[model samples]
Target: MQHPAVPELAHTHTRPIHWVATATAIAGVVALSSLLQPKPATAAQSATPDAKPAPTTAPSTADVDFPLDCGPEQALVVKKATGDLDGDGTPETVAVVHCDAPMGTPPDGVYVLTHNPGHTHARVVATLIDPKARNTVTGLTVTDGAVLATLLGYSTADVPSCCPDVKDSARWQWKDNTFVRSTPAGARSI
Candidate 1:
């Protein structure tokens, strides 16, 4: 056979030591690249220093002590809706709360809650329905900065608490620094 012009290469045959050295070099490159990543990119600019930060989150109902005397039972939130009710940029929460009764129907109390951006606790701004009225909220919603509710009430004191004899649809709007309540129509007997 004719003599080859070039000699055989040593790396053509990979030994255990060659594999170990190659693995170490690859690991080193990966570790070095991870430590040299670029900063994250953003599209929006930062806010001005003096302007008030827009409130992002609506107030929560937890830890809010509603104006209701449950006696031995605690106040429980059944339904809630959030919206900007007072024409303010920040949103407010409307909560329907009632006593945690084990037996009969308990009257519900509807309250409006507002919390400043940095405040720790949310305060009650308005009480739409008091528990003393003995009314149960069948449906509640906040739409177009208005609080609308379907209320179930009694026609007279003789009516039993278990059965409400009157059904009314009520709407409350913020006007003149107070919530003005107006009924779309007269209460109907159920």
Candidate 2:
């Protein structure tokens, strides 16, 4: 027969329950961490309206005049003038001048002129190049009574030489009660 002390010792040596409790606590911690983790952003949250369009600047018409040396031999006459280049209700003028030199020559070439009121001044816009021949003027148009003239010069690949490529354009509009450069098309105001 087992002694009374043997029964007591058996009860005292119960399997350690700490390992099961520890495993359960570790599982809970893992689940909580997964629930708190960051999530991917959605389209609505990522989208923002920060970009904006640029404001347009009006052209200046302080000094308006055609060059003195403008002729078939030296300058180009107004070839086809339509839609008020000066923005006056009257039709605008256009001219196509021929050069005595070749395509790549640095002679005065084609141009368009917008006459100012009182016949006092004329705005002369032209396409020209330096010593190296290259198309310097690209966009030549009239908008809202202003003459927009663009000058796009030689490109590095176009000119093998080290000449600087100059790209610029001008706009003419009326200002100070004078037909400076800003005149809406088809309306003549001297």
Candidate 3:
């Protein structure tokens, strides 16, 4: 039955073309939306007059003279890890260094290096393991504001330099404006 008030609407009938057109328009909208995505949100706050920007780069091990007296040989950084060890915004580098020796195993010194915001060179802030300890750092890492290391040492002076008889695990954490050393576990004979 046709009503006099409104003629039969042609668009009211479902057609294949109408479906195709509607689907294409929806696809175009989705594609456009993907390309117009908003920038990712960051927790970083905008720079203020008194606020100092956090350091982006960690301290470098190269060129920084360590406290170890290598004498004629050069100091070599064997392993290094970087992290925010002092709860400061800036990161520090934990380096396992030893003298470049051509022969027997050389003792390693673990040092913490920090670079000042505007400084070009990094300076050694703390010495975790002194070379005089006659220990070799087998593994070094900085995690959760703590410096961890596996050290190999001689049981006595009679122990040959080529071989270490004792194995020890060490951890250092920043506390009270100083790095405090703690033996996490008991040393074992290797």
Candidate 4:
């Protein structure tokens, strides 16, 4: 059977069609993979607001202030103490930090900061944050490689500032690289 020669039909199955077909197939595969593959987590999607970060350096060696300097607008200082409790041939500064909330007598916390090696600034060694409600460190002393923090707890919110109904003390020892709390003078732990 003799057929008529067609100039346009010869190019129909040429390299251009093959290239177009290959490109379409690649595009289809890419689209299908994008739909089926698990989405990569973005910063906002994976971010955890309540996540506490692991300590990068030893608390006894970190160069931070005891009060944490949480910015003046948010917090304030309530009490301060100075002595050597880490047995590192140096004195440390202990401070009680109080947050500024819209209530009567904010809760207070305790921290220990050491004087910098060059006497330039103080660096934090340990922290006892948010010890009790409406309470602050009544007294603190660093001796015998121990930190004796006297915390005064209040029975009611409307109690006097000086006389707390309950007087509690926490003792911390700088063991190895961290602070370990021990039993106080009249405390029994289970």
Candidate 5:
């Protein structure tokens, strides 16, 4: 009997070809990962060549208790301000505390903590969480019973936390036993 129009060689081996291609791609990815992996430091490189000698005298801030109070579990610490925030004569505290630091989007914000002489605990009076804008409070000034917080806002939302181009110096006052924004310094015009 006469053979059909095409030869056996004309038929393509589809399944094996696909399998080969997939295997090759997987092998290439594995090889690339090995090349990109960070190398561990050797014992020879442990000694820093440019390291300075140990200080002969004690540090100037040895007696100072900076970053005061609370243990590692303390989520909030007074980073910038500490004064009579509520005009209660006792020194109040102001700090940068982002409640969403470990969970949602970054919102490292300014907070005001009022000290209580009756107890060891302090209460939060004001919480200014600028999520879509500022990185952190650069400086805080309590002037004439008003708190002025200088915040560094980002140039773009996609930018990192450390690099902020815009400056929002907002003013807040403790009036009627509450923290009120005296001057609104919201996000800059994008």
Candidate 6:
């Protein structure tokens, strides 16, 4: 067959049109192959059989005791008792302690104790100053299934001033073995 002598016709008509489609198909195959391949094993899992097992540390026992001094005064009384603060099946002992002198001043007064379960040991969870003052814990009342402790006063050192607000009340729970600060959210291990 006789072909045209024009340079444009000779060059344009010779190249394959399927090159772009072939490149696209090759790219798809490469991507699919990579995705189908299995991942290499992690170093720890692939270690030699003779490697020694990692040593385990014992759990801490910090939560076992309550903070004796709410601020500066020492704990005067630690009355042991049990109740379900959260209404859970587990009953925790409540430590109702009285601080002899004011946390910072002389005649350090009474304070309540609650438990923190997260800690290994029990500790004093919260302290309530005299009930006469504003933002104070009035009393400790345990009903059919609920445990309520009134906030008598705020500790300048121990508790935050804006406590017992609508959303937050100064309360404690018995967890692990110590008293902890109780909040509407839950008991905070001291």
Top model by lDDT, which number? Answer: 1
Evaluate model 1: give its TM-score.
Answer: 0.70
Model 4 weakest lDDT span, ten residues long: 54-63
Candidate number with the higher lDDT (1 or 4)? 1
lDDT score for candidate 3 against the true structure: 0.88
Q: Could you tell which candidate, 3 or 5, scores higher by TM-score?
A: 3
Rank the candidate models, highest lDDT first.
1, 3, 4, 5, 6, 2
Taken over the whole model, the C-alpha lDDT of each candidate is: 0.91, 0.44, 0.88, 0.64, 0.58, 0.45
Tell me the deviation in Å of residue 84 in model 5: 2.3
lDDT of 5 by residue, 58-144 (tens): 122111222323244334433555666665555666666543344333445566655433444555556654433455666777777
Cα deviation at 41, candidate 5, in Å, is 78
Instruction: List, residue by residue over 14-103, the lDDT tens digit for candidate 3.
Output: 999999999999999999999999989899776799876676789888789899888899999999999999997789999999999988
Q: What is the lDDT of residue 19 in candidate 5?
A: 82
Which digits, one per residue and each the tens of the lDDT, describe model 4 over residues 69-136?
Answer: 34454656666666556665556666777766565655677877755454445666566655445566
Instruction: Tell me which of candidates 4 and 6 scores higher on lDDT.
Output: 4
Cα miss at 135, model 4 (Å)? 3.8
lDDT of 6 by residue, 122-157 (tens): 444444434233333335554443445544344444
Residues 42-72 of candidate 2: C-alpha lDDT, one tens digit per residue = 7744435863322122222223333434344
Deviation in angstroms for 78 in model 5? Answer: 6.0
**Model 5 residue 138 lDDT?**
64
Alpha-carbon runs more than 4 Å astray in model 5: 1-78, 98-107, 130-134, 160-162, 184-190
Please state every model's RMSD to the true fold in angstroms.
14.9, 19.9, 11.7, 14.1, 23.5, 14.5
TM-score of 6: 0.29
Model 6 scores a C-alpha lDDT of: 0.45
Model 2 spans > 4 angstroms off: 1-81, 85-87, 94-98, 107-135, 153-164, 177-190
Ranking by TM-score: 1, 3, 4, 5, 2, 6
